[model samples]
Target chain A: MSMMKIGGWIKRILVLIFALVYLAPLYIAVVNAVKPYDEIIKSPLTLPKQFTLNNFVEAYQSSNMLELYKNSIVITVSSVALLILLTSMAAYIIARRKGKVYQMLYVFSLAGIMIPPVVTLIPSIKTLSALHLLYTMPGLLLFYAGTYFSTTIFLYVGFIKTIPASLDESAFIDGANPFTTFFRIIFPLIKPCTATAIIFLGMWIWNDFLNPMYILGFRGGKTITTGIYNAIGAYTSMWNLVFANVMLASLPIIILYLCMQKMFMQGLTSGAVKG
Target chain B: MKHNKLYDTLFLAPGFLVYIIFMIIPVIMCFLYSFTNWDGISASFRFIGLKNFVNLFQDASFFQALKVTLIIMVLTTLIYNILGIILAALLNDTGKLLGFSRSAIFIPTVLSAVVVAFIWSYVMQTNGGVINAIIEMFGGTKVDFYATPMTTIFMISGIICWNSLGFFVVIYISTLTTIPQEIYEACKVDGAGWFYRFFHITLPLLAPGITINCILSVAGGLKQYDHVKVITGGGPGGATQTVTLFGVEKAFEYNRRGYSSAAIIILFIIIVIFSIVQLAISKKHEVEY
Candidate 1:
């Protein structure tokens, strides 16, 4: 009994140590964000002598925090909303229907999952420019919709399958049309699957950097990721400002993850494990 | 129930329209563009038929970018999976420490790659950087992480792994939870040790998770852009340039859309090949219960 107790304590201690090391970069970013430049240079590893919020204030102005938030929120919200609605509706059909055409469509959608975003990015620029949608928020939003359509549909199809066809059949028997049946009964029942889709798509669209950097060119409005990258590019050596920008860009998402930690983990693993 | 053509068309048409135009058409266009000598800005160009691919084969920088991309891909994939499994196994217990550790590890995974790269660049900087600060405090020499392109690429790969290993660990942990306790219990009854059970039982059961994680990581690593871009911008004469970065620079900076399309298509092919091979291998190794 004593030996087992000792072994358990050893494992706990080891885990604690590993956690600290894992969190060291974040700790450094937080501590240095509050310190003056000289203080950080003098002792990067030490606790702040005098904590200040000046860095946050300066970072907010320079990075245009409000505009960044607005742009990121609009893009993320619109992209995810569009993704869930379109993919779920498409998935419902794909799950319910039978025939070579539906099977072909399902396979066609899955093919998008294998194609990296970069594959489409180059040619899409031409397509967007031709449509006069280049360097716009709507342009980026549509790009994301197209890019993630496969994975989102894959998740929804798997989930919509477990929901028996009887529900849809009953709704149809009640003199409702297909759209009415899907919207009233089927959609509401797939709340858990929708949550999984929302969380996964939300995180990806929010954190996306490369697609926005290109599709939304310099003339386009800035997102949190690209805005911060541009802001910090000029001041590479300004550790205080850099850390502050990093914190601002990350804090919202981190807080959201913490509050909904369970959902985040479940949503992430569900798409991977099941698909 | 009879199938309603109107409802089917209404439901599928909107999403398929956006998807085909933006996703499918572009992929087809990428292949079509590779055959031409289109210089992005011009509306007119002649078909060059395999010239871009032939040129890509001859371009030294393309090969360099391919080498750098492969190095980062292999290194990050191995680290994310190997270290991920170990961390998941160690933190699989149901204790406060385990919970705290899991959350701490996963926190970075939520942050943007650009943000994570910036923070790591600060941590790994030569002068007064956190890692160097600690080393110097202990009477050790400070290492310049950006001493060479190879070193910088390797360090950036490590940072990418650090940022994403949490994600892999979480998936592994979820898979771990699915394995029955009876297997390990039986192993213990037979005098099997921790390593013995882990190798024999835990790993085989975890193969499904391993397959998914490997495919995701390999595709992700091959398409790496944000972190390397933020850290090095593939600088010092394209020393640390990834294939994606190379293709982007070619398309945007040099306006060689045709050539750049060819470059990315090659990368696309590599990713597809790797994913298919991994799925096949993992499927073969997957133990049936």
Candidate 2:
């Protein structure tokens, strides 16, 4: 019993130390963001002798964070909403139907799961150009619709499978069409799955860098990731400004994750493990 | 029942249209483009018949990028699984501090790779960086993270693992919860030590989770471009370039669209091969219980 108690104490202390080390970068960013450049360079590990919000002011202005935020929010929101609506509707049919065509379509949709977005990106540039959607927000949105269709539909199809078809059948018998039955009846029952899909899709689309950088380019607008990347690129060693920009870029997503920590954890793990 | 066909078409048409036009066709086009010598400009180009792929094999920089990518893939996957399991074992219990630490660890996972790269590049700087400064303060010499291309790539892999370690840990923790407590009790009754029980019972029982984490971490590592791009831009003479970065630079910067498509096709093949092999190996070793 004494040995076990001693071992537990050691484990607890070790975890505490490891956690601090793990979060040291975030702590550094937080502290240094408020410090002057000289102070950050001179004494990075210490409390700042002179604290100012100059870095945030400069970073916010230079990075055009408001515009970046607008772009990111619009893209993330629209893409996720689009994904949920289209994928969920299609997933309903695939889940309920037991025909060869639906089965083949289900397998076809899931094939995208393995094709990394990098593969589609190069050739999509040509397709987008042909459609006159290149370097446009709508282009990126359509790209995301195709890119994430597999994962979002996979989640919805799995969830809808567990919902008893009888409920939707009753709604159909009550003089309701398929759209009315799905939107009014089946959709509400798949709230948990929707939550999961939203969390995953929102995180991916919001934090995406490569796609937005190339697809949107400077012609359309910059999302938070690309904006911050360019902002910090101009001054790579300006640790103060870098920290401020990093914090500014991450603040919203960090808050969102914190608020929905439980859902984020459950949704991500379930999506990966089951998918 | 009367409108079943119409409903199905209505539901599937929009998504299927986008998927086919944007996803499926682009993939097919990517394959076709790999064989041509199209320079991504000029309407006139010739199909060189695998000449671009043939050149890729001879290109030293392309070989370097492949090597760097594989190294990162192996290193990050190893660290994610090994450290992930350890962290999951430690945080599997219920406590306020444990919950706080678990959430804190996951904070970086939510941040953009660019943001994470920016913060870490500052922290790992050779001169006056936080890690080196702390080491110096503790009576040690400074460590230059960018000492060489290999060292930098290794450091970048560590940063990648740091960015997503929480993801693997969470999966492992969830898997841990599903194990029956009576098995441990039974093991203890057999006079088995903790290590013996852990190895015999917990490790084997965690097979499903292990398989998932292996597949995820491997794919994630192979698809690594953002952090490497943000931190080094695959620079210092393109020593730290991954396959994706190589493909992007060639296509966009050099206008070598055909060659870049070949690089991406190679990456896609590697990822597919790795996942399938991992699945097969895991399936054979999966415990019935």
Candidate 3:
């Protein structure tokens, strides 16, 4: 009994140590971001000797952090909102109706799941350019709508299917049209699915690097990811500024994740189990 | 019921219109473009049959990128699953410390790959890097992570694992929750040891989750781009380029749009092949508990 108890304590201590080491990069970034360049070079692992916020100030300016934030917010919000509205409505029909057409549509929409986004990127550029939508926010937004349409629709269809059809039938009996019944009755109940989709889509769009780099281009404006990439590229070895840039770029998402830790966990693993 | 048809079209048209024009058509266009000698900007180009693919198999850098990508895919998948399972087992219990550790590990997954790469690029730097600094503190020689193409590939793979290992662990933990406690009790009643229970009970029951994780990890690894691009820009004479990065360079820098399309198509084919094979293997191993 005593041996078992000792083993439990040892396991706890080891896990704690491993967690600290796992978080070492984040810790290093936090400490170094406050230090001056020379101080960081002297002791990258130690706490700042002379604390400074100048790195943040400079990083914010040099990266045009506000503009990046604006572009990212606009893109993420508009894209997620658009995707949710479109996919949920579409998923509702596909889930409720039993027909060859709906079944085919379901398969058609889900076809994008296996096709990596990179495959569509170069060709999409041509299409986007032809439509005169290249280097525009809406172009990128539409591209994302296409890219993630499968995954989002998959989530919605699965969740919507689980909700009893009788709920919508009652809504229809109460003089609610299909549109009204869906928006009023069905949409509200799938908040969990919507939440999962929002978290996944928001994270993907916000953190997306390659697609945004080309689709948005420099003129369409930089996202947090591309803006930071360019900013860090300009000052490659300046560890202090790099740390500051990384922190500024990451802190918002990290804080959001922490505040919604349970939802984030559920949101991430929700789709995995269904697979 | 006439209006019902209209309503269905109204609901599906907008989404499917955008999807068809932007998604399906582009995918088809990609297939068609792969056969052409189009230089992206050219008004006219000829369909050169399988020439682009024929050349790709001969391209040495293409093969190098494929090797690097395969190495990273295999390495990261192994670490993410093996370590992910162990970490999941440890953190599966309920406690404030376990919760804190879980959140600590998952924090990185929320951050952008660019942010993760930037933090790790600095952390793994040779001269003034925190990793090497700690090594020196322990009376050890400093290690240069980017010393060679192979080392850099391994380093980047490790960084990739760090970035998303929490995701795998979370999935595993959730899968663990689905198992019944009665099974464990029964095993314990039969005098089964910890290892015996894990290998016999836990492993088989976690098959569904393993199948999902394997498929996800394999695809995610094969499609890797952001971290390698941000960290090395596929550098050191392009020794570290993944197939995607390689294709991007060819398309944008070299203006070999047709060739780039072929390269991406090959990657897509490879991903499809792997996912299918994995699904088949996992289907055979999947235990219905």
Candidate 4:
């Protein structure tokens, strides 16, 4: 028992060390983010003796953050809503029905998961241009539809399979059509899966940098990420604004995740497990 | 009866049409473009058939990017998975301490990769950087992390692991929670101490998490763009560039459209082969509980 106690103490100390390494940079970031540039440069690692809000103000103004947030909100919420609907609807059919076509389509859809996003990104430029939807909201939405369709569908398919066919059958017998059976009976049941997809995809699209940088065209609009990237670029030496800009870009999503961390992690693992 | 088939088709239509038009078609088009001599802007180009593949093999930059990507991939996977499981095992047992540590470790997962990259890039600055300042305070000489290719690679890999380790930890934590306590008790009764129980019991039971983590790291690592792109911009003479970066540069900057497509196709083929080999090996070890 004495030996075990010693071992436990050693283990505790080692874990503490590892946790410090994992956390040091973030703590460093917060410290510097609050410090004046001179203080950060002089005593970079310490807590700020003098804190200021100057950086946030500069970052917010230079980044055009309100516009960026508006654009991001529109895209993330709309795309997530559409993705959940289409994926869940198709998933219900695949889970409930009996046919080779359904199985074939299911397998066909899964194939999309293996293809990397770049392979589609290159050729889609021409296609997006031709459709006159290049640099447009709907165009980017469609891009997301194609990009995330596989994972979203994978999540819904696995979950919807767990729901009994009896539920839909009873609805069908009670004079509900397929659409009716799906929306009223099946859709509500798959809320957990929908929640999972929403959290996962919402985060991906919101924080997405590269795709929107090119596809949406900087001149067309700026998402939170590209907005901050451009913001920081203009005021490289202005650490105050830089920190504020970073906060503005990240705060909303970070706060949301913190508030709903359980749901977020559950959604993350569920999507991974189901996929 | 006819209407059921129609309804199925109708329901599947919008989603399938969007997918095929934008996804399946573009991939096929990219594959086709890889065989041609199409500059990105041109409306007309002739099929050059295998030329892009030939050039890609001959290009040193391609090899350099491949080397960098491979290095990052291996290093990140090792750190994230090996350490992730150890961390998870420690955090899995219930205690207020464990709970606090778990939450603290997962804080990075909420922040964006760009933000994480920015913070690290600032911290790791050689001159007047926070880390160097800390080093000075400790009476140690400051080290320039970006001094060499290898150090730069390690720093970027560390940041990547930092940005993502939370994900692997959470997954492992859940996987650990699912393991019955009796298994550990039995191992203990057999005179297995902590290390022995870990080696003999915990590690084997965590195989599924390991397998999943490895495959994910492979796939995610091979396609890594955001962090490295933001951190180094594939800089210091494209030495830090990835395969994806190379391909993107070709398509956008250089307008070597067909050649870039070939690079992506190569990446796709590699991902396929790697996933197959790993899935095969992991399937053998995945013990159903």
Ranking by DockQ: 1, 3, 2, 4
Expressed as tens digits, the lDDT of each residue in B1-289 for candidate 1 is: 9988998989999899999999999999999999999999987999999999999999989999999999999999999999999999998889888898999999998899999999999899898778888888799999999999999989999999989899999999989998999889988999998899989999999999999899999999999999999988999899899999999999989999999999999999999999889998998998877
Task: Give, for candidate 3 chain A, the lowest lDDT window spanning 10 residues.
Answer: A266-275
Those runs of model 3 whose alpha carbons end farther than 4 Å from true positions after fitting are A1-3, B1-3
For model 1 chain B, give the 10-residue run with minimal summed lDDT. Answer: B128-137
List of clashing residue pairs for candidate 3: none
Residues B9-76, candidate 3, lDDT per residue (tens digit)? Answer: 88898898888877888888888989999999989999999999999999999999999989999999
Candidate DockQ values, in order, are 0.81, 0.74, 0.76, 0.60
Can you write out model 2's per-residue Cα lDDT over B1-289, one digit (the tens) per residue?
4557888899999988998988899999999999988899878777899888889999999999999999999999899988888888899887777888899888888988999988888888888778888898899999989989999999999999889898899999988888899999998998999789878998898899999899988888888899999889999889999999999999999999999999999999999999899999998998886
RMSD of each: 1.0, 1.4, 1.3, 1.9
For TM-score, the strongest prediction is 1
Question: Candidates ranked by TM-score, best first?
Answer: 1, 3, 2, 4
The better candidate by TM-score, 1 or 3, is 1
TM-score of chain B of 4: 0.96
Per-model TM-score, in order, reads 0.99, 0.98, 0.98, 0.96
Residues A1-275, model 4: lDDT tens digits:
99877867677767767777778877776666777778876676678889977766666777889999999999999999888777777877787677898899899888888788888998887899999988888888998998888888888888988888878767767887888878888889889988888888887888788788888989669988887787777766666566667777776776787788789778877766532
* Top candidate by DockQ: 1
Error of 3 at B257 (Å): 0.5
Which residue window of length 10 is worst by lDDT in model 2 chain A? Answer: A266-275
Displacement of residue B20 (Cα, Å) in model 3 is: 1.1
Estimate, for each residue in A1-275, the C-alpha lDDT of model 2 and write its tens digit: 99988887787778878888899899899999999998987788887799899999999999999999999999999999999998999999999998898899999999999889999998888888889999999999999999999988889899999999889878888989999999999999999899889988998999999999999998889999999988888987888888999889988888888998999988877776663
Compared with the true structure, the alpha-carbon lDDT of candidate 3 equals: 0.90
